[model samples]
Target: MNDARPPLPAPPRPVRRAAAALALAAVAGSAQATDVFRLEGFGAVSRSMGGVATAQDVGPAGMMTNPATLSLLQAGHTLMGGLDLVTTDIEVQDQATGARVSSGHHGSNRGPYVAPELAYAQRVGAWTFGVGAFAQGGLGTEYGSSSFLSRATGGLDTGLDNSSRLLVLNIPLAASFKVNEALTVGAGIDAMWQGLNLNLLLGADQVGSLIGASRVSGALLPVLGGLPDLRGAHFSLTRNSPLASGINAWGHAERIGMTYQLRPDTRLGAAFTTRSHMADMEGRATLTAVDGVAGQIPLNGNLKIRDFQMPAVLNLGVSHTVSERLQVAADLSRVFWSRVMKDIKVGFVSDGGGDLNILLPQDYKDQNVLAVGAAYQWDARWTWRGGFRIADQALRGSTLFAVIPATPRKHLSAGFGYAVSPAASVDLAWSHAFREHLDNTSLPNTSAPIGVNHAQDNATIAFTWRF
Candidate 1:
């Protein structure tokens, strides 16, 4: 009777809870949300005029879209910066049942992210030199952990958050040479930084199928009871927790551009950007079994991603002054999406344990963007601008999904600028794109056709100073 009950075995509850908390905090500081894959433009000036910066010498922001435009900057140095506030609403539904696939928390992932712009240029003799920073664009979509899709596989408590996030920033140090009055050539090196986080849910069937692929080669079957025969299984598996595997990479690219004065009143411009190859991403991936295997096992380990590169870009534009007070500009750009994203491969980081490999199909087709705008000097201190743009979708009919479902197709924009003073001015613009609806019936793994609708509204403001 004097036996003091052995101190209650250290409760396993605390240890389990601690492990869960650590997993959630993995991608904490680095998580950034965005909505658009490519921002229409870099600064307020570009945003206001329907992203028309290629030929008309907009400012330092032009250095990013078309470095040759740097040759058009005024003799003095210029500084400009702006912030973009964007909002997106997307809804994905099961085509057959008309039931929503997501949790109805539309655009919850949308955030007011900053698109910074900075540049300084000086003209000496026949050369103009400058440096600047800009954000091209990014994509962000988030769904609740207890979404309709999640519930289909297990109970509401199953932690399943499906989302995607990407952010890119570029800095260019460049020089422009006015070889002669009619022609200006420019070139630069770009320091590009990119970060990405992908968290997706996979059905047991899909995971099982991936295991069957020749690539996996029975290497992953031994894990978690040899990959259950999920063909008819009701449970699901989540790829990884956000913290486990996030990508923070750096790379470089080259840019060359030229502007030729077709006539005193007109200018033709072109710019080319080489593809940037980023370092492979390394992090941890935690795959948890739900429903049938609930709490039975945890597949967590280091993950490695192959080098990912953005597509090369080619832009050709023309700017013409119809009158002393009116100017019109147009640009056409080709993005080699097909070359960079034909296939995406993900592998496991073998630190003392075995790993798995998988290839996600993404045969994206190359796309083009067309933009046209007009700027009119309404008065000595006021200017008005308007423009329109159309961009082909990178993701096609079968591959579109609930995560990052909105791929913009067309945009309309308008704005104005006020001359606060000779050396200082402010610009503002607003843009709206109609909702795009996509129907997916051919994609594999879909029990029912998927339908998605996406719409957006964007606004920007920037202050510029000349010194």
Candidate 2:
């Protein structure tokens, strides 16, 4: 018998280091959201009532919507935990090639995406203090390697994966003060972490268009200009590992809010959350230059993502008690997406004196959202809740929009609350976002439009314990 066996191959040193760096970040893998990358609501109570927490007492989740509402917590201590299950149905169609592809969510191998939340609060004298961890918002999608969208080199399948995921998580510490019988004011600071993963392929013409439109004025420009004909070349950023090992960054923001009693049965609330100040997202990426004279060159480099931050938000709301058993609430909010999402700026620096910058335009519009909800007490142990939410789609039809389709425009939700005991309770909620369709009219170098479809179903369950 032959005593010698071939030594098992190992991954390259750079790949090993990249994987180690990503593991050290300790970030969870995949998350999806509604409301153009934001969840329609944070907790079971809030989602059941169409995200109407600005003036309502929804336990420690108030730290995310309106910290002032924390003043409504019962005396002593409270603990809350919740989980959100999200299911998305997405389809992409290349009109020119008459090919269609469905996202991984539609297959039996992939299950619904999950996000978790936890919070604790304490009330002492006229002050309420709270802390919580919440998933702020994100968007993600994945297409299989066999999909038509993964084709390169004149419609030949390259078995390349195409996907993107962006996740934002927030940790907040807040304090609320009861200024009198009728007013409560609160403020908080939030430390946030964001992670992004992308595996994309662009044709030569698309790369050329991006370079032309981008701000590229360095030694790199002359080098790119001198390259051989790029008509058949393609650019790709992909890795052998999974999407979880992409890039991560940390940031912080501030929020202020107030709630006032307009009448014994009516309350008004307003809150403002500042934009996040995040550091550049940095990670290792495999950049491939294929076809043309480049002839399949693989460059290992560090990718830097600049000017990627969440936009500021402003919210105003009113809650009114219609009867001893009935309550209603409404909220209007504005999201300043145009300010932060104008373009995606990325720079790549290779170890061998090669660097380039690319700018992908987003041109997102500010979004206006309206939410309305009502709750009814049923007997002593059960409360019924229902709500509706609506917002316009923010991104215009384009190739990038198809990859990151966060375009749900309307939602219907319903749920119930049950009092398990005097000190413990449970809340359950379900929501559905109707189907939305978009035409990709602005694809680079292609006049034929691509069709994108998206819809969603979300369920949330939360448990609360009060001492």
* Top model number, lDDT: 2
RMSD of each predicted structure:
17.7, 15.0
Q: State the displacement of the C-alpha of residue 238, model 1, in Å, after optimal TM-score superposition.
A: 13
User: Compared with the true structure, what per-residue lDDT tens digits does model 1 show for residues 97-169?
Assistant: 6777532343333344455666677777788887877766666666666655444332334456666666677
Point out where model 1 deviates above 4 Å: 1-36, 101-110, 152-157, 209-218, 224-245, 294-296, 350-352, 442-448
Candidate 2: residue pairs that collide: none
> What lDDT score goes with residue 296 in model 1?
32
Candidate 2 has an lDDT of 0.75
**Each candidate's TM vs. the true structure?**
0.83, 0.87
Candidate 1 Cα deviation (angstroms), residue 106: 8.6
Worst 10 residues of 2 by lDDT: 24-33
- Highest TM-score scorer: 2
lDDT of candidate 2 over 1-467, digit per residue (tens)? 00011233444678556544532231122122246878888888888877878888777898898999999788889899988888888888888788888877422223366778899999999999999998887776777668776665466555666676777889999999999989999999999988877766666566666657664444445555566643322233433332243777899989999999999999999999998999998888866655555555566778888979998989899999886556788888898889898887878887777787777778888998888777765535667677778886787776445567888878888788887776778899988888888878554523235788989898999998888
